[model samples]
Target: MGILEKIGDIEREIARTQKNKATEHHLGLLKAKLAKFRAELLEPKSAGGAKGEGFDVMKSGDARVVMIGFPSVGKSTLLNKVTKTQSEAGAYEFTTLTCIPGKIDYNGAEIQLLDLPGIIEGAAQGKGRGRQVIAVARTADLILMMLDATKSRKQRTLLEAELEAVGLRINTRKPNIYFKIKKGGGISYNKTCNLTHLNERLVAQILQSYKIFNAEILIREDCTVDQFIDVVLGNRKYVKCLYCYNKVDEISLEEVDRLAHEPNTVVVSCEQNLNLDYLIEQIWYHLNLLRVYTKKRGEFPDFSDGLIMRNGATVEHVCHSIHRSLVENFKYALVWGTSTKHDPQRVGLAHTVDTEDVVQIVSK
Candidate 1:
């Protein structure tokens, strides 16, 4: 159960309470907030393995990849192409009624991926269930604006415009800029590249880098959402991934090349199984995450059951994320990672860790 489930429970309770005409502060606020909460809850959850892109157990940079595009544009097909997911794919629109998650192995690191419901025009007006998916885009590390290359240029523009309305900018330009630079070469005959999303803070004076503007999740470390979004999307040093182009089975190699010229864009065919491996490789490198293994007595530990924390996430937060009492009783955490040479089972809370470290928290 997520925040929505809990909000739903409260709304249902308030509705039941209101049936008898008990309109108090709690009930009144519930009434006012019910609609918003419902919208947030219905935002197509990507509850999948390792973790869903842009979704972590907490409100942090745990997972980082989300796919948003028009319906039937092969978003779910790409979801199945990479990551640990078994989502449904079809020839018709809106086949994926929910957001699905998948896990992909990137150079020994675990990268989370999300496949969301399709977006249609006027989604902000709740047109064709677009509003729901727009909400989910708030919780992503990166957004993949999947487009139909086979569609006419007018149709593609229409899709891009719809995304723009939702505060997400898709990279669809040809004249090269600083989004993704060519590996080798200077000013003379510099190969043009197509970037997947609008990654740069500003593409030029007229263009803002295209991306989903989910204002809620972009909170500063102190809880200021606006500042947080600025840092995540605007920070050039942050590890950003690629924009995935799917459904290439019906398109031409030349078209794919044209798209690849955009910054961080990859061409793939989920239907015909083309270039999927290369796409994964690019995504892994862009994410910049690494995995280290931990074993005791030559046995693997359960990551799900195991409390996984980021390198800087406080021990208190981990305790709370696992169970509140640990944080309430709040002793220290006994970490078991590369820092400890003793038996893996015999480490203490003060031990710092390297990546893929296994830890055990000791509390009263």
Candidate 2:
């Protein structure tokens, strides 16, 4: 039987099975099996086939964001409106067949925005270049999950599921589980805290399903079976996503207010230019970027433009971002901002810097 058919059968079985303390281990094994089969199906075919157009786009900017949704959901329009890029927008579906790139300059940071081809149901099964589209999204710093205000909410669910199937965990943090494989220690399990959803036996069964016989596992937080499997697989992308409900001008104020209250949701009308600035602000906030100004010896700090870094960035990270050689040739950094103890406090490469911090690198 084909891999998809087998996967379908297993999914049905899982659905039919009852969940209980006695059956938890069995269910965990089934989930692990399903994940393994899906991974196998996603692997490239060994048999040579005709080469098709590739969707790989060179990433250019401080950060990259991609627009993803069903066709005719105003992804292209929003891209054009915000970034001034001329991606064709139409009333018909599938108007965008390729990746269209644009740049959004906000607060001295350049963010790359990509308008990807619309995704449909069965995308995870390689239907209609859906895999290619998702592959591009895997590299993004953030995903803009656009939805038409008039469309059914089922579209959003389908899009999220398809992305999840491809190992994209949206708006999720990495599981607080430390997993290591040993040559022959016989699977040791440790938990720093109580596990509300998983037990040791079920975790062992799931690990065995992946052929992991000897490993050390540590769980620091409450997590689910799927999360454990994700850690074991080790190819999942944990990314932040913004749920953008476009064409809000066509909807009622009550509807806009309702959507605005939803977590990580932004309601905007690209055609009417409504709430675009707020949307941009939310993007900047969620990206958690840090802007650091650089200064040379006995020179004023450059404020016109600053080096963009992710939150929790350190002086060592700054040096690496500037040039690899800087890390080796570096001595110390002088910081003049909230991260410093006194005015222009001298700090080492390990010193973490905050936004608007002025840094001067003194190297021999």
Candidate 3:
């Protein structure tokens, strides 16, 4: 009768049920219920327990990336090797009892790298400080899933499951499903393209399970029931995860090569100080950051200190980042970069900025 029990039962049912067109609706409803129960399980108790200690580190830098894996997987070692901050690196399990923060400055951007405590199997169920670790993981811009190259591949699978159970969709994009809850109209289901996984009936059943009687549903792409569940919950973190396999020195070259070839995977040996630079480069790439240099009217642009901005940032964003009051002055920006057809082209607040662009804001 508990939320966990309900979630387990639904999961078992979903696993045992044969996948067919006949059972699609049943499966959809079951997944919706499972998501509901999981959400409830994660809700705070009425007793209002004190939060875990050392997990409240203030977020700094342009982006945050958290190291997550089982203990003794070289998370701390990697953190210590990459960043100036020294996290305790040990050969024993649970060496890191709390969240440890470090900083990495690469390509004019400051990245906050956190070495989180090891995550256990039942992390979603709040086992072994799993809840606290996962709570911090959700806040990260990227997840550095550190694994042991010497260990079996099961570690990666289990870690993925634990994070997946908690609504962390790694290296994945959000489902292209347009869903809106209407006040009075009945379900208006439409699809732009052919959807093989979901139909109007199954969609209606899934929506009704969440007590959504009136809604507008537009299926833009072919997505599964679980993805639809994620859309309905609307709290899932679709983050980019880089699978970092440490201790590659202990593994065979063939094994190391295989891991390195895997998508979004990096193989490194923190103890041997190998491939750490490339790992940092990959982190910068996946973070999707941009550096824009600012110029005064007469003086040259300070290329030494470029303004770090996110990808797809605009002139307005640049103004706000420089100073909140800059936008209030109503100015135009002179952009000199690949983004402009001519050198130092004048643009408005809506103009998107590119990496290494020289921006000079002219106020009215």
Model 1: lDDT of residue 212: 28
lDDT of 2 by residue, 241-353 (tens): 99999998888889889989999999999889999999999999988898999999988988997999999999999898778999898989999999988988999988999
**What local distance difference test score does each model get?**
0.54, 0.91, 0.90
Instruction: Determine the backbone clash count of candidate 2.
Output: 0
Candidate with maximal TM-score: 3
What alpha-carbon RMSD in Å does predicted model 2 have with respect to the real structure?
Answer: 1.6
Give the winner by lDDT.
Answer: 2
**Cα-based lDDT at residue 346, candidate 3:** 86
Per model, state how many residue pairs clash: 21, 0, 0
Candidate 3 Cα outliers beyond 4 Å, as residue runs: 44-54
lDDT (tens digit, per residue) of candidate 3 on 1-364: 7777888899899999999988877888888888888887887556677755638889999999999999999999888888898888788899999898999989988899999999889999999999889989999999999998889999999999999989999989999999899999899999999887788888888888889999988888999989988998899999999999989999888988888999999999999999999999999989999999999999999999999998999999999889988998956889999999999798999999999999999998
lDDT of 2: 0.91
Candidate 1 structure quality by residue, lDDT tens digits, 243-275: 667766777778878887887778777788988
Considering summed lDDT, which 10 consecutive residues are worst modelled in model 3?
A: 45-54
TM-score of each prediction: 0.47, 0.95, 0.96
Candidate 2 clash pair list: none
